[model samples]
Target chain A: MSKAERKAEVVDLKDRAAARQERLPVLKTYKLFIDGKFPRSESERYYALTSANGESIANVQLGSRKDFRNAVVAARKAFPGWAGRTAYNRGQILYRMAEMLEGRRAQFIEELETLGASRSEAETETAMAVDRLIYYAGWADKFQQVFSSVNPVASSHFNFSMLEPTGVAALLAPEDSGLLGLISVVAPAVAGGNSVVVLASHSKPLAAITFSEVLHTSDLPAGVINILTGTRKELLKHFASHMDVNALVYCGSDAEEIRTVQLEAAENLKRVVIEENSDWQSEERQSPYTILATQEVKTTWHPIGL
Target chain B: MPRNNAALAVTLPPQFVPIDEVGIDERVSRFSKRSIKKSSKVQALKLALSMLDLTTLSAHDTPERVRQLCHKAKNLLETMPELPHVGAVCVYGPLVKVAKEVLKGTKIHIAAVSTAFPSGMAPLKTKLIETRQFVADGADEIDMVISRGKFFEGDYDYVADEIAAVKEACGKAHLKVILETGELNTLDNVRRASDIAMHAGADFIKTSTGKVQPAATPQVTLVMLEAIRDFYYATGKKIGMKPAGGIATAKQALHYLVMLRETLGEAWLTPDLFRFGASKLANDILMQLVKEQTGAYQSIDYFSME
Candidate 1:
């Protein structure tokens, strides 16, 4: 090409670059959510998050086992009050969380977009997350009636069985689905009146932190749902081995992590539930059984003698 | 003069200087930031274990619980035979005999919370009676709470006399004067209380009763440590320091150790000079030691609960 033509091409490219730089996006500082506060990881480490096209988007806190340990402490501390709240009050809090999520829809969608989800897919995930909250909110009070049983014994005794929340649950949110999977896991656990410490999707954690903000503002108590940003493999063992954590819920396909969780959870006889499914958007994802997964059945017998 | 007795004149300092709150906080934060690494961290954890006064001062504590606590004080972790047990077993005055039975020939001693314990509302005669009883029951040390009401009334003489009276009653048992710093509500008050306790004959100056709102924070502990340091310089006698309550994490324990070391040097690292009055701190230290020995984190389930 001639010098004049090459110069013209270069000028056009410079104009394009200037136009793109006119509006710089504000980057969010993603941090670990422990007890109800967003703190830089105690380890002070970070992991770069990039778009599918390899464009750097933001930096996420690379939580250490210490962070998970802190989260478990928070979860255990918050367990009694969260579990003791009236079922109706818990339902109301969950619904309030849904309201807060609704108010933050655009932010969640934007975060999803940064994670490289298509615009429509991002909106869908955000909506599903809000719906998941609402769904669990409805079930919070109803699950008791649905699952409880008044048993007939051979003797003249009043026998009844009911479900109770397992204390503090440590969970790994599905690695593939950010907002929706997180809501699905946490809603069921919280609906069953259990406090949860969850490690968010390592590859896509923006929405999880945003969701923690929602939980923070709503009536939900501090430490009811703690979110951590880090690699699942690195934090999985800590999540499983924490003595204070009463339940372990995993939603990932990695075989080694599954095995490790099972083996470590046996130390405390923690309720280990592993549900690895890829399609979170499917109808089968929402069920009372998910709530039951984090609950314990307690039976009582009282003799009816006057 | 007995080597253990210091400042025979017993003249109270004319004025306790007001601490620089911001400066103390900044220094504590700095001390907290020291990056203790692997082998050294393990060593520090062990040292912290050796400094713990495994305490169970609950109102519901039974002889069985006291015995169990003493048992734990003697054998922190059977799996790690080399690990030292906690410095002592602390229980209510009435249960001192139970703990003494379990701790008979071991290096672990028995600390009894006497003088009405968590509360110091009783008459002086009653407190002396309690202290004398605990000593007779074989308690190696007596933890006594000061009268905050009298201190708040500007009755400095009453406070000093109470400490001296309690000390006389303790006789052979070492006296730990708990200022209950949380009730004092100010750093200057904490400093003044520390001076009063030390001048009136306290072997160890403690921060709280483990029953108050804000027990044993770094600022308060630092102020008390500084008081010990000053007393040591003036009289050429060492006054031990015990930061009891709210120090439940290995990291927090390390921070306290750092402060103690920086303030009083390596001599205070031993159980005799420095100690932690805590029921949960021992388990947390053991968990850290286990985590260090085995890369995997620990469940409290594996550790026997007293």
Candidate 2:
């Protein structure tokens, strides 16, 4: 064929490929994470997740209060062991999780594409999520050094304080970021030695569960991280008021609801960390100091005289 | 007739004043002749600043960056006392909250650029919903772009009705209709857009979305401001003006201010009549103010409240 005809043929092939892509069936799946296992809901209730174009991509189970309780219990049970580990060991585990995430980057990108993210956005979010994990992982051992300070007391007692993890935290991941939001909230709390019960993004829960799978595959002990998929109104109230939850971390666009939860947390004086609706792509996200700011330090004094 | 003749006869001998007898003093002409002193309040400058393009500093220029730019601009505005508070920080819908937080408790309002922004290619329903959501997120203003596609196709009614719908959806929040004069390609189209927007209940007529390559030139701003003046004169209702996109430095802001002062006079100098949609211009103005006050150029580190 002539050069022009060959170019026309190539164009024809490209058009056919595009047509084929439009006709491909969208796969749908959903399950809950309880004690490091993907389990079907006891109630068997499922909610349809749709795209901006109104096409159904998946059906996510509407997890119940019982599911939330179970996750919290599992998190509480796992917290002692996970929190007891040395900071270096936890850092290494988080770092390894980042590597595993990098290995499955394509899976996340595919899931994001199904959830309506543009190809470029999906790639950037996936890379940023992995990098965020790595960034927080590095801060795991150093957060204490930055947040902690030795006080110069008038007396003989040496006084120094270091940030301590608030245990069994509950997080409401942002709806826009399917995987990155899940990882952003969970990794920071976990790196600080706090076990988390994450309420997955209602519209895009598949990637959250998929990341849970990655966590399960990693050396993370069962119950150290529990993922529950449900409505924010349904699950967030329980998470906020639960006496056992030591802290609450919420990341979403619902300002009023988040504020209500913050007020509820005040009933027990539970530590509240509300991530404002912010562009995660901005320079504000790179501040390692924010992760340290969310935690607290506990100090004790001893006498060395006689 | 007799009474009129007697009155006219009494007015016959008027006092003669020669040019030399009239003591015309330079100070009298300079001071007592309605001096029309320019306002030292910087209100016109503030309005021009509100329409400036403040997103040039981003790593990648997109709607998201436009949102961040508004946020940074809002933060910078917090420090200035002389500049009239901006009407709103215009950005994409997703970043409305960022501007909301940055402008919390201040007179300045949050404005989101909707209707597909620079292009206005999205469906009208989507644009309306996006505008509504931004208002729901505490945006006090909506800056929507005219559909360039429809405009180019000579679908003037479609473009006008879209602006009307967005204006209605804006509820109590004011709507600033952007003409994208650079894309309009003619002063006639710009004038037509201004008239259409005004007839459609637009609170203000704006220029450019800042995403287009050639945004908010002085010529365009001058034309739009003249249109606003004409519309007001014809209808006896004042319409505001916003010249946005690619306006940065203090000198450019001053030029627009000068234009508004010279063209619209004092009435359009307020935030209600004029605004600059800028992110970085606020800081540059503030930096200049600080230098003028302190007699030294402060380091960039000094403005690190963000």
> Which CAPRI quality tier does the interface of model 2 achieve?
incorrect
How much does each candidate deviate at the interface, measured as C-alpha RMSD after superposition?
Answer: 2.5, 22.6
User: How accurate locally is residue A252 in candidate 1, as Cα lDDT from 0 to 100?
Assistant: 77
Worst 10 residues of 1 chain A by lDDT: A235-244
Go through the candidates in order and give the C-alpha RMSD of each one to the true structure.
6.6, 25.2
Best by lDDT: 1
- Positional deviation of B163 in candidate 1, in angstroms? 4.9
Candidate 2 regions off by >4 Å?
A1-28, B1-306
A287, model 1: CA deviation in Å? 2.5
> Taking the tens digit of each residue's C-alpha lDDT, what string does model 1 give over B96-165?
7788778888988889898887789999899999899889999889999999999999888778877888
Cα error, residue B79 of model 2, in Å, equals 53
List the pairs of residues colliding in candidate 1.
Answer: none
